[model samples]
Target: MQVRLEQVTKTFAGSKNTQATAVKELDVTIASGKLVGLLGPSGCGKSTTLFMIAGIHDVSEGHIYFGDHDVTALPSDKRGVGIVFQNYALYPHLTVWDNIAFPLLNAKEMKKRLKQRFAELSPPMANFKAYIQRLVEEAAKLVELTAYLDRKPAELSGGQQQRVAIARAIVKNPSILLLDEPLSNLDARLRVQTRDEIKRIQKQTGITTVFVTHDQDEALSICDEVIILKDGVLQQQGPPQEVYDHPANQFVAEFLGSPQINLVGGSIKANKLYLGNEEWFALPESLSDQPVNIGVRYENIRPDRENRKQAFEATVTSIARTGGTSTVQVRLADGQPMRLHRDSDDVLQEGDRVRLYARPRTVYIFNAEGEKILQC
Candidate 1:
């Protein structure tokens, strides 16, 4: 199902008779059978947005359409969306098979809804047991949990338990799947492996999915399109790399990149962009002279001794090495700190003074109000 939100707003009544908007007018469309990520920091309304789509939270204004059907007033259970909570929410006493089939057994309301949705394919009430058993087995196989069908939640690993939770969500053949921070409980190594599994399952099932996560790497790695939010407002929505490469504003540019993008304080004077009181780059003669934030990505920064005349000087302060890559942190001549990712084999002492240069065409400029002035 294609999920679309049109000017969907969510508000909460706060203390002292005031109101706080958890999600502002959000207009977004998730294509059929696509996995999309709602990404942002804590208290950014990402989870609230997911809840609104799940029909758990009623919108303050506007409507939600599930492939042209207005499901704005539908109850969560009636919306045909399966929600997997952050903690996985598996029952400790139940075996893997039972846990997956639990939703089916207790789905009194779902039976009525599903019968109406698929009237021609609906089986008789007496055949419901066989139907549910088939669904449980199919879901278990889909998530590769058939081998551990009889194992309890405690017997399985964190990743395995997560897969069982996913199986339970899909057993009902939901119109859309809603996962809220489902990978946050796993270990680092397992998190990576499980995210890949989630992506694989999504592609195999071809079920439209909305995944909520605060981790940028998780979103960028698995999602087709990532929607970034800030303070209840939509910042940007596009393919992961597109949003990363070309951010809409300073917040997105800084939030999307690892180690964050370096924002050097700059001033425009007499058609010259000056950094740390030194003329850094040339600006247009017609542009007004004002303050600007120069954004330089880590990958764009490189050690350049030959370009001393135009390079910025900085002293190596620290280095973090992992695998074949190293992250180097340095303090500029003006005492501003900067960080960059480079080859792990770079032979440089912590106190060594080096000249740094950024790819001129990749540099980004933002105005004092945090709007993008130039992005190349």
Candidate 2:
């Protein structure tokens, strides 16, 4: 289903008679049958947004819609949204078939009794049995749990149990599926395996899904679009590659990268950029001669052995080799530390002075207030 949120906000009473806003005026639209990720650090309100969308938490202000239906005031069970949590929430004593059939049974039983009470309805009770059986079988096959139909939750591995939880949710055939850090409990290898499986299943089922996670790599790898939050506010939202390539602000630029982007303090005098008491590069005419932070990726920097331009002389303080590539920690002339990646055959020893040059286009300039300033 296509989900829409209009100025949604949630607040909770905090200690010392203050109020904490969990989600602040968030407005977003999730297209039908797409996997969208809510990514941010802990306490950034990703979980709160997911809960609001699932109708588990009430919105303090604004509205939510599923297609043309306004479901902002609907209760959790009435919203037709399925949620799978990190804990899986599987019953250890119940077999896979029972677990998957539980929701269908409850829904059918409720509908059956309601139909029985209506005097105008003379339909036979036998008609519902076939429908329920077909739904259960389809759900089991969707999650690939048909072979383990009779197995209990305890008899299955972590990944298998998670699939059971998914099957249970899918049996209801919810219009939207909410996943809250579902892969956090799995091991490294299992996490990767399950992540790929989730992508495959999502494609096959074509259900609109909202996945919440604090792991940037996980979100970037699987999600078609990503919404980043900071301090309960929407910081950035865009395609994964677009956001990674052009961050809206410093927080976003710093949060999305693996090794973290490097920031060096520098001043713009006249038209020249100065760093470490040395003139580096010429700034664009629109920069207006102000102090700025230069952001550069580790891989964009190259260590020079000769004929370096605007090089900051540094000594190798430490080296870390991780198979194919190595990270070299260098101490600048100003005593600041910076990390650079190298794949050169000639390795530099500790305490060896070397010159480093950064590519011009790879440099990102941020003003004093931490907002990115793009060079035209």
Candidate 3:
């Protein structure tokens, strides 16, 4: 199913009669059978938006559609959306099979499905138990939990319990799947493993999936497209690499990268861009003089051990190495701090003087209002 939110706004009543808008006129579309991520920092209203789509929270304004069907007023149970939460809300006393079969046993839904099944089959399809059992088995197999089907939730590992939750959510064959930070509770390695499994399952099922997460790495790794939000407003939405490469604004550029993008004060004067007092690049003549923020990815910066009287110079403050990569923290000549990516094998020490330069084409320039003004 293709999910669309058109001008969807969600508001909550605050103390003293004030209203807090969780989402503001959000308009976005999730293509059918694609895994899309709703990514942002905490309190950015990603979860609120997910809940509104699931119909757990009503929209304060606008409409939500499943394909062409307007479902703005539908309840959670009526939306045909399966949500797996961060906590993996599995029933403690239930075995994996029972948990996976829980949604299949819903009185109203089961009755409707059984009625349709009987209508479709000759002799009324009497073996209903086998049908539910087959569904449970298939769901368990999809999540790789077949061996643990008879075990209770507490008897399983955290990853196993999470898989059980996922199996439960999908057993009903929902039109859309919603995942709310489903890997947040796992250890680092397990998080990676489970997220990959999630992507695989999503592909096999071909269900329209919306995943809400604060982790940039997870979103970039698993999603077909990512919608970035900040302060209840849509910042940018695109394929992760595209958004990372061509950020729509300062917030999108700063929020999407690891170690964050290096930001420094700059200005344009006489069609020339200056970083600190060093002239960097020439802008179009039609552009007026104005202050700007220059953003450079750590990878774009080259740190040279020999200063060579370059236009920009810095002193290495510290170096942090993880695995084979290194991050060099440096203080510029004008006392501004910056980070650069360097080879772990390179010899460097604290307080070492280094010259800095970024690829001109990779730098991003943003104006006073945080709008991206130029990319060079």
Top candidate when judged by TM-score against the true structure: 3
Q: Name every residue pair that clashes in candidate 1.
A: none
TM-scores for every predicted model:
0.93, 0.90, 0.95
Number of clashes found in candidate 2: 0
Instruction: Compose the digit string of candidate 2's lDDT tens values, residues 229-295.
Output: 9988888888999988888888888898878888777777787887756788886564677887777
Residues 1-376 of candidate 3 have per-residue lDDT tens digits of: 9999999999999999999999999999999999999999999999999999999899999999999999999888877888999998888888988888888886586557745774676644557777678779999999999999999999998888989999988888889999999999999999999999999999999999999999999999999999999989999899999999999999998898898999988888897888887787676445678888889999988865564443477899998989878999998777888998887556779989867777677888888678665663
Local distance difference test, candidate 1 = 0.88
lDDT accuracy of residue 165 in candidate 3: 91
Worst 10 residues of 1 by lDDT: 117-126
Steric clash pairs (candidate 2): none
Give per-candidate clash totals. Answer: 0, 0, 2
Residue 42 displacement in candidate 2 (angstroms): 0.5
- Indicate whether candidate 1 or candidate 2 has the larger TM-score: 1
